[model samples]
Target: MAFENPSRERIGDILASAGNIAIVGLSDKSDRTSYMVAYAMQNKGYRIIPVNPMVDGEILGEKCYHSLAEIPEPVDIVNVFRRSEFCAELAREAAAIGAKVLWLQQGVVSQEAAEIAAEAGMTAIMDRCIKVEEAITMQGRTRKTQ
Candidate 1:
């Protein structure tokens, strides 16, 4: 069967409606793409929850969790920054945690991960940047400050 690609309208809806995003693999390093993207999204008013096992403290002032399941509240979206090969595991974890969306950033794609999220009835976005999506979605609107 051919996989479903979310329509532009739906993608825009997901980008704008998701309230909280769990940014997996976000590190303290400012130069990391994960950090840069998270910063952009946060500046757009999306609450960012950092998930990195190696991170001892918080990133972007939000407490970092070792895993998505450890997060205290519902995750509107699980934005993965890990390697493509590892997304399946993250997808399973996101499913287990009951996330509403599974987002694999640019250069990251996994059929297994996509299947896992789709099977669990979660919205899945692959090979896309949440920040870019948000920026485009916010065009002509008043941008919010982080």
Candidate 2:
């Protein structure tokens, strides 16, 4: 069964409360999509942990984690930048690590994976940009802080 998406408002709260993010499939190259998106999220105050196997060193000032399972600290969000077909595996890892959210980046979606996440009681969001959702759904809070 397909899972219901947590509303953008709820996603805002998740993103707001989330302390660290494990960006799966992140690249070491500065020009990569994962790099740019991670940069944006990092600028927005989210601690983005890069998880690309090819890169032995750090990117964007954060220590690179080889895998989600290798991350010693708690990861509040598991952001998948890979294709839809691979989300299920990532979803399983997220659930095992007790992650609170599974976020599929734009153009990535997997109903099966979402279902698995939901079964594990994790909030599931597919095919959406975290930055965009934060800008739109958290307007009320944004106004208050301004």
Candidate 3:
């Protein structure tokens, strides 16, 4: 069976309900897309867990983990910043960690990864920006600045 993303309402629901977001390939650099996106989500009230092995310390004031498995708490979503070719493994990790959603950033899509997520009973969204979705669904809402 082919993989499919949730409907618009479902997407909005996912955005509204999710709290902890594990961002794979997240960078500490403020100029990077990952950092900016993660910052936005953090401002929107979701906990951002940075998963990147290159530089380890703190990013966006949160401790960075090398992988999803290292996170201590349950993750609601796994937001990937890697290329399409890297998604399948990340999907498996997200499922293993009991994440409810696997979100691929814009311009990234992998049918194999989506299928894996579906088989694991996780929602898979590709080629879409999580930040954009939050802004759309949470319009007119004030984000926390702290």
Candidate 4:
């Protein structure tokens, strides 16, 4: 059977419940999509941990780590910005750290990645933009109340 992503409501719940997001392959440059997306998520109250071996010091005022294994604190989400080929290994790392969600940013997807997450009992989201989903879903919830 194929892996299925959680419902939109559940995605919202995951976003709301998660506090820290470890973005693998995150770039320090503002022009980069990874940087912009991570910055937006940070503004939404989620702590952003940048994972990039090329960068030193801080990317977004938070200390950057070289890999998921290096993150000292518990990570709620492991958002990947790397290519599809790299996701499988990331999936294993996410599972190893016990992350709640394994999210592949827009245009990045891997069945192996999703399966790995599913096998490890983690929510897997593929080919989706976390920032877009967070905005749309959260806005819909707000509109319902108003």
Candidate 5:
């Protein structure tokens, strides 16, 4: 069977309920898309955990974890900025870490990865930007509203 992304409403609900977002492949450079998206999500009140083996220190004032398994706290969403080819492994890692959602950023899509996440009982979202979704969902709500 083919994979389908969640509805906008479902995505909104997922975003609304999510508090801790573990950003995989997050870049330390300010110009990178991963950095920008993570920055926006952080500003919107989500706890952004930077997951990158390359970085030694913080990216956005938060501790950088080498991998998903290293994050001590529960991760509500595993927001990935890596390429589609890397998602299946990340999906397995996300499942192992008990993440509620596997969100593949824009331009990244993988049916195999989505299936892996779904089989693990997680909401798998592919080819969508979390920052864009958050903005779209928060269209009418005030900043204080969540």
Candidate 6:
């Protein structure tokens, strides 16, 4: 069967409720999309946990973990920046750590990985930008108050 992303409202709810976001394959470089997105999310009050095996130190002022399992605290969302081929393993790790959501970044879609997350009772979102969704969601909320 084909994979489908959650509804925009659902995505908004996920982002609104999410506190700790573990970014896999996050880069230390500021020019990277992962870094930019994570930085934005951090500024928006979400705790960004950098999970990059390559980075020795912090990426966005938070301690960089080697993997999701290495993170000491609970994770609300496992945002992946890796390629499609690497998502299944990351999904498994995210599930093992009891993450509430498995979010695959834009251009990174995997039916197998989505299925893995679904089977584990995790909300799996594929081929979307978390930062973009958050921006849209936040805008909607702001307009609703106006």
Provide TM-scores for the models. 0.92, 0.90, 0.93, 0.93, 0.95, 0.94
lDDT at residue 106 of model 3 (Cα atoms): 94
Q: Flag regions of model 6 displaced more than 4 Å.
A: 140-146
For each of the candidates, the C-alpha root-mean-square deviation to the true structure, in angstroms, is 2.4, 2.9, 2.7, 3.4, 1.8, 3.2
| lDDT at position 65, candidate 4 | 93
Per-residue CA lDDT of model 2 for 17-102, tens digit only, reads 87888999988788988888888888877788888777787989888877899889888889998999999999999999999899
Tens digit of lDDT per residue, candidate 4, span 1-146? 77677898988888877888999999999999999999998887789999999998899899999999999999999999999999999999999999989999999989999999999999999999999999877864432110
Inter-residue clash pairs, candidate 4: none
Error of 5 at 99 (Å): 0.2
The whole-model lDDT of each prediction reads 0.87, 0.84, 0.90, 0.90, 0.92, 0.91
For residues 24-136, write the lDDT of model 3, one tens digit per residue: 99999999999999999888789999999896799999999999999999899999999999999999999999999999999999999999999999999999999998878
lDDT of 5 by residue, 1-146 (tens): 98888999888888878889999999999999999999999888889999999999899999999999999999999999998999999999999999999999999999989999999999999999999999998676544322
Residue 28 lDDT, candidate 4, scale 0-100: 91
Q: Distance from true position, residue 67, model 3, in Å? A: 0.5
What residue pairs clash in candidate 1, if any at all? none
Please report how far candidate 1 places residue 117 from its true position, in Å: 0.4
Q: How many pairs collide in each candidate, listed in order?
A: 0, 0, 0, 0, 0, 0
In candidate 2, stretches whose alpha carbon ends up further than 4 angstroms from where it belongs are 140-146
Lowest lDDT sum, 10 consecutive residues, model 5, at: 137-146
Residue 112 in candidate 2 has what lDDT?
Answer: 86
> For residues 43-64, what per-residue lDDT tens digits would candidate 1 score against the true structure?
8788999999999889989999
The segments of candidate 1 whose C-alpha lies over 4 angstroms from its true place after superposition are: 141-146
Candidate of highest TM-score: 5
